[model samples]
Target: MSIIVRDFQPADAEAAAETKRAAIPYLVLTPELVAWQVTHAPGNQRHRLLVAEVDGQVVGSASTGIFAESSKPGQAFVNLSVAPDARGRGAGTALLTTAEGYLTGLGASTAYAWVLDDEASTGFAQRHGYQRSRSSYFSRLDLAAIALPSLPPLPEGARLRTAADFADDPRPLYDLDVEAAADEPGDVDSDAMNYEDWLALYWHRPDLDRDLTSVVVMDGMAVAFSVAQTDRRGRYWSGMTGTRRAYRNRGLAKQAKADSLRRARLAGCSEAFTGNDAENAPMLAINGWFGYQVAAREWRYLRNLTD
Candidate 1:
């Protein structure tokens, strides 16, 4: 079977989404999200989604781009995934080769990819000359079967709301996300404060579950929020959970996450997943308290493009 890599076409969206979901079950993804990403990826990001086809069927995909918002310039990313049944074929290598060339052409000096902590997966990266760096864990909880903790009563002057409550103006949410994103421990820091950009990519994202997303309101402002996303199958994921700097040290992030998870369970979600940097002790503690256990680990692998 000949494996060929090519740019994503509209007709390939569903197959690409399916390939990704099959390869990485923890992520919340859909065809619409794939299409939107191809269209609206920031100009500087040099984003390109590639698919690998074997005998006219798509079996693998890669999301490649320059990390435009990272504080460190010249950093790029390429994450490739192949359907389990399609794994031993050369699709993964084909996809990675195409992605690396694309990012290098866009002036990226360093390329990074997340490698699953498995023998075969790690071996692939090592063979490709990628060196491992920090690791992160994926955790899941039985949302429908697990008992949720009683939500602690909101402090006086504080209340709970949803992202929909800020439809008229989501600037406060944007500000909170920017602050929290910067604090997130990662090789690259993201600055996602652009309102129009956020609305187009995040607010309007097809997978974003607005109703289940919980926000803590203080003085009628969004101080802390847990962004939620769900797939067509009702699998819920915590896209992000963050609190403003002034609101840190309070249990607000935990509260928002718990509230969202409870709502997801009520809505018939069977499983919920989230990821945390190994260094993020607070978030890990919160997930552990909610019965989330480590499902898998992925390490960041980096290689200098020029080398």
Candidate 2:
């Protein structure tokens, strides 16, 4: 069977979402979110989504874009996923070729991809000229079957709130995110510095669950938060859990995550997922404390396109 790779059409959203979910079950992907991402991407991102088809059936999907928020220049990323049954049919190769060409044309000197931490996946990346880099872990909690610890009583000057509480003014939360993101472990070090961009790319996203997003207020300041994303099918995702620098080591991040998970469980969510850089010990420990076990691991791979 011949495999064809082409730009993704609006009609392929459901199939693309299915392909992605089949490849990485813990990710928060839905048809609507996919469509929103393609139609609403920021100008700097130069985002493009592609799909691999075989005999009129879409079997793989790929997303490529410049790392607009990266401090480094000429950095781009391509993430591709092929359905298990569709592997080894040239779909992956075709998709990668299309993605790399797209990035190269956009002046990207380097391309990054995340491959599952397994022999076959690693070998594939290596064969394609990508070198292993940092790794990360995907963790999941059975919100319905596992017991979540009761949120500890707040300190004298702290209380919990939801993102909805900031509807009138989200600048405080955006500032807190920018500060917290500076310390996050990643190959690229960049802060979400632009409020308008952050509002367009994150706060107003279709998948964000404002009511379920938990925030910790210390003396009326939003010091910590756990952003939540949920699909209608009962899967909840922790988009980001962060605590400001001054509030570190105080279990405030845990409190925020716990509160968010509790809210998700009460809202009938069955499974909860989150990811962490392998070296993020504090967050890893907190996830462990929440009974979230590592379900999968992925290693970032980089290819120097300039060479």
Candidate 3:
């Protein structure tokens, strides 16, 4: 069967999401979120979601985009996923090749991808001229079954607030995210953070549950926050958890995450999932404190488009 790779259409949302779920089960993915990503992607990103099909059945997909948020130009990303049953049908190769072409067409000089820490996947990446870099871990917490840690009392001047409190203006939360993200360990350091992009990428996400997102406000300003992204299926994803730079080391991050988890559990979310860069030991320790168990690991891989 020949593989046909083409741009993803709106009707392919379900199929693409299913393929991604099969390839990365720990990821909290939904069709609506998949479609939203494609439509809401910032113009500078030059985002394209490609799908590979055999006999008219979508079996693989790739999300390729320029790194618009990075101060460094010519950087891009490509994440590929294939249905389990379609692994050996050349779908992966087709999608990867097509995605690389697409990225280069957008003037990308470098492309980064996440390859599952498995022999086949890593081998494929290496065979395609990709070099391994740092890794990231995915963890899952069974909110329905785990005993969430009892949060410590907030220190003076600190109070818990839901993200809903910022419904009128989320600029403070955006500021918190930018500061926290700067310290996040990753290959590409994002030095450019924009408010409009933030609103589109995170605030407007259909899955973001503002009521379940916890914010630690100190002196009437957001000092720490945990963003909760979930769907109707009782599953929750920790979109992000961070404490503003000046507010670090005060356990506000833990408090914010704990509050979010507690509320998520109470809301009937069965499980919670999150990802952390392997070098982010503090966040890992915090998640460990919450009894989050490691589920999977993926290695970062990079390819030089000019090579």
Candidate 4:
């Protein structure tokens, strides 16, 4: 069988998305979202999606790009996935090598990738000189069946509202997102400034559930929020949960998350998943309090692109 790896075309979005779903089940992926990512990713992101084909059937995919949002320069990411049924082939290695070369040429000095916490995946990364780093687990809760925490009454002078409530002006949402992202723990930085981009890429994205995305408003400003995403099948995921610095220690984050989760359950969503960096002790503690258990783990592996 002739095998080839090449840049992803618009036509390949569906197959590439399917490959990603097979490789990383925890991620809530859809063809429309995949295509939107390709079309809306900032030019600075240096984003490129690639596919591996064997005898004309796509069997693997890789997302290679610079972490432009990151404050640090020279940092990039190359994540590759091979279909479970197609793993024996060289598609994975081919995709990885090609993606690495592409990012390296783009001036990336260090590239990080996520590999499943399994023997074969870990072995592949180790053999490629990638060092394993912190690992994070994906957890899922039965939103429809599980008993959600009793949401506390909105604190005095504070009110809960959906993202949709700010339809006329999303700047508050943007500000909240930026502040929360700045506090998030991760290898790469995330600086979200362009409101138009966030609108196109996030607000208008197919998965974002604005109705279920709860925000805490105190007086006249948004202070805390929990972004929610629901799949085509009603499966829910906590896209992000954060509280602004000025409002921290007030338990607002917990309130927003609880309200969002409760809303998701009422919306017929059975499963709710969320991810947390292992180093994020506060968020982890909050999720644990909500009875979210670890379902799967992924380790970040980094390789010096120049080497």
What lDDT does the true structure give each of the candidates?
0.87, 0.91, 0.92, 0.86
Best by lDDT: 3
Clashes of 2: 0
Relative to the true structure, candidate 1 reaches a TM of: 0.96
Error of 1 at 142 (Å): 0.7
Off by over 4 Å in 3: none
Candidate 1 local distance difference test against the native: 0.87
- Name the runs in model 1 displaced over 4 angstroms: none
lDDT of 1 by residue, 43-86 (tens): 76778999999999999999999776676778999999999899
What pairs collide in candidate 4? none
Q: Which pairs of residues have clashing backbones in candidate 2?
A: none
* Higher-ranked by TM-score: 3 or 4: 3
Tens-digit lDDT string for candidate 4 (45-122): 889988999999999998889876666789899999998999967888899889988987888999999889999899
Give the range where candidate 4 is weakest over 10 consecutive residues by summed lDDT. Answer: 192-201
CA lDDT for candidate 3: 0.92
TM-score of each: 0.96, 0.97, 0.99, 0.95
Worst window of 10 by summed lDDT in candidate 3: 143-152
Models ranked on lDDT: 3, 2, 1, 4
Best by TM-score: 3
